[model samples]
Target chain A: MTISFTDAKSLNHDQLEEGTAFAPRFDAHGLITVVTLEDGSNDVLMVAHMNAETLSLTLESGIAHYWSRSRKAIWKKGETSGEMQEVIELRTDCDQDCLVMVVRQTGRGAACHTGRKSCFYRKVIMTDGTASLEDTGLPRLFDPEAVYGG
Target chain B: MTISFTDAKSLNHDQLEEGTAFAPRFDAHGLITVVTLEDGSNDVLMVAHMNAETLSLTLESGIAHYWSRSRKAIWKKGETSGEMQEVIELRTDCDQDCLVMVVRQTGRGAACHTGRKSCFYRKVIMTDGTASLEDTGLPRLFDPEAVYGG
Candidate 1:
């Protein structure tokens, strides 16, 4: 009894729009974009991609899992850092090429490998036609160097 | 002095982490992921992609612009629908491959082609090894057929 999704192209408009079918449309690469947000506050924690296996694991376990394109492996969030994300809600866009997961971040509450609360800790500033970045001053919740080592 | 970004590979730890340089890492297709969120509420409006030109325009004009992969064209969000998103803040992740935009949604406040307030209007439910979607019951702010024509 494992949860599963249907093929997006096979679904009719009613099923796609109003019905209960969960048909996700994966890109040619067999990956779908996943946006993770912190529960309650809804702050975007990170953006990643998920393959079918990782997606199913996330759904079955209520824990966040992502496909690591760079490593060519499946990533179980917080497996190494103890910063797991427990799914509060999972949603998909109109066509289902994208996913949104509202989760209760556990442990140190940092989502970025760099130890930031969120991956996006810097703002882009454009002034006088020149662009630069400014730190948002969000403190790091953990020491990545200590956790992952050099 | 037109704003420009450095090649992602050229950035060192300091340049990538703390420096003011804005070096975005575009994918092989020359696109970067952009996530839009409501300014005050932080509600995720939509997720899209941007090419270099669209990214520059977004920064220069303080308006959201995206690259439509399916259409093979640039998209000025809300151009025909009058749902322009004014950028209040633009953020980049640690490596700069992703962007998060805090925007003031203008016009009807609908960010989805389906006429919904946000692109994600349904929640996914998995019970007894079966997955389905449930409408969040968020009313349409406008009619798509009326706005874009049937």
Candidate 2:
């Protein structure tokens, strides 16, 4: 059975924000942004998008599923890499256009396809009015070439 | 001086993902997704978007600035509600299409327009194939009516 969401258009602002209804206001592309966080450390794992079908799949299965804009298909995260994410808690924002998912990252605890613990492994810095990215010293948890076999 | 970004088109996959250049891949709308987290607690405060100008503004000013889709303008967060966010650190993902900002939420510590500490103040639960939202019990740090004036 597919989980159904309330119609966000039918609710008033106060009801949408403060009520018990789970009406997600998807963007024009029928996608909602989702930020995934590691359960215990609260570290942001990755940011991705989800269509309604994938969202429902995630809720029903307790595994993280996302819509790949590039692939234009449903992506069951960590499926190929043996790093499945087990949902701990799922949250929606005030307007319900976005989501915060707390999950236990399985496998080697790598969330990024690049074998990084978290996707955000580099910090942005300004040097002489020019912006550059600096590695945050987070070593790769696994070798991507060996795992993905590129 | 307006900060310029490296053209993402010029970079190859390895250069884009594994290199040190800070080339952000903005969407067709000229915006990039951003996830903001509370500095110490690592709690996600909000998810928003940043156009190139606002992204530059944020990096230069060390304050949070977002493209307000509803308002169709740059939103210097906490400018009106006295809840301005001072950026602590800024990190981008492997692809640089998304950003994670560590910030200190100022002025009563509210990050949501609803006067909550974080925009995500509710949890999603599925019961019998029906999804419902449950309050996470995060109290308002300030009164919205008094702060924004109803």
Candidate 3:
């Protein structure tokens, strides 16, 4: 019973509107898990939150777009870094609350700003009666020090 | 718009009540996504699906259990294959319709039956008017013929 359960109660604040302008809205923790789908192998490139605009852009451009909560704007993967993710198919849960973006990676590195190949490059382990981070070996695919001159 | 948009819905037929003796039930499609917590990474390792018993044993043993829809029954990951997942945390959406099982992976291979490390081992792209898979080097850790034997 080490695992405690919590609910995404914030989602209760809003309701789904089904109309021409009815774009789905998610609370703080809602997300689109953009996955890299290559040859039947898949890995999560990065996770992004969706605003109506980004979702629309992704639907139109075939590239994943997300709302940066901190930047307060839309972020297209590999926009500045060139590590773009070209989405192949966008699937949603039966409820339409969450989205799964399966894409083909178009660049050398991951879609994260940190340069890691995947945002999920770390692993967690509950040992010694507590969970800790384990590096998954895939790290900053692009050499930032060589590029930025550390 | 070929796709129809709808509100979020969940299948809440099965409820676990400590040593509850019974068969678990879900709606037609059943539960199709599981949010597994990637231990150290704090990132989600992957999202998978389960029927009912897998969900049950997951709660029972603290080890990840999933009903392989493909195999069509209760399947304990890593039980025979040594690729088991250790459950650390569990969560649900506001409606309790979906389930999230955070786990620690025992990396003999992928949680996915596919040769790749994870089921999410591919990336896709739109080109020549068709979606193509992006080679993300998903099977870096595994050789299908090597582990599962051709």
Candidate 4:
């Protein structure tokens, strides 16, 4: 099958409307590329799924929204955690089957199942010095309980 | 373009080989879904990425392997943290785009950063009260320091 290509930097890319599942509209289908904010430390402070609606919401609101598996529903960032993710930029890969979201994580903590700061908590192993199972550093500056709860 | 459908229960359905990434292989592109495993406490010890290779490895070794993005390699579960994720059984969604990796987390703490056990450490907003972010009991499990030793 033949597929068309479009450059995200200069394209008709815009905020999708309500009820639009960005994942389906763009045909990105099943791939979500999460960008790490901190250069060396990959702390995930949010975990959002892109099906389309939330994708558009992210683009429009400049915030992150996701599909909560446990809740089996749509979720808006900072809706409860008070930790919102601001969109820095958005990019789609050459194949268009995936999307990359660059955002600045608000609040302090990982954006994953684990309460670290990034979704990439697990480190990768290689021939070189062992990679961090994940970037782990809660330097008081990122303790929500200390800041918010305390 | 039209897409072909396949049986997820079958072995040929987007399986992956377990190990960290060495180099991007043709089969690496087969990863279409992420399977999650959490014990009774809502503790997500680890999250495994399944391409075609690691999926097969899950069946063979009964452990988890995922595509290591940072290291540009493949990784086996507990290969580093010793908190290996033993495969219990694998389940796929209706569309076959993702899989539910029901696994038993054999570890000291969590499979995440911030030294918590499980990728999901806390729950943000439970809109419908359907999901509660069960605290895996605050404690350091896989000490990134002790293991990696920065």
Tell me how many clashing residue pairs each candidate has: 0, 0, 25, 51
- The segments of candidate 3 whose C-alpha lies over 4 angstroms from its true place after superposition are A1-25, A28-39, A145-150, B1-34, B37-150
Ranking by DockQ: 2, 1, 3, 4
lDDT, candidate 4, residue A55?
Answer: 55
Give the distance in Å from residue B39's predicted Cα in candidate 1 to where it truly belongs: 0.7
Q: lDDT winner among the candidates? A: 2
- Identify the superior model by TM-score, candidate 1 or candidate 3: 1
lDDT of 1 by residue, B81-107 (tens): 999999999999988989999999999
When just chain B is superposed on the true chain B, each candidate scores a TM-score of: 0.95, 0.97, 0.68, 0.65
lDDT of 3 by residue, B1-150 (tens): 111111133222222211111222243666535666566554344565676556655655678877665577677776655778888765432222344455788876466444445454333344443432334445545554566674
Show model 1 residue runs off by greater than 4 Å: none
Off by over 4 Å in 2: none
lDDT of 2: 0.94
Q: Between the candidate structures 1 and 4, which one is better when assessed by lDDT?
A: 1
User: What are the per-model DockQ values?
Assistant: 0.84, 0.92, 0.04, 0.03
Tens digits of lDDT, candidate 2, B28-119: 99999999999999999999999999999999999999999899999999889999999999999998899999999888999999989999
Quick one: best DockQ, which candidate? Answer: 2
* lDDT tens digits, residue span B1-150, model 4: 111222333423113111122122222356544534464443334443566566556555667777765465667866776877776655432223344455677767455544455443332112232211223245666567787676
Give Cα distance to truth, residue B19, candidate 2, Å: 1.0
Name model 4 segments beyond 4 Å from true: A1-48, A51-150, B1-28, B122-137
lDDT of 3 by residue, A15-124 (tens): 22111112233444554443333323445555446765576677667777787766888888677777777766654322234555767777785654456655444443
lDDT of 1 by residue, A26-145 (tens): 888999999999998989999999999999999989999999999999999999999999999999988788999999999989999989899999999876787889999989999988
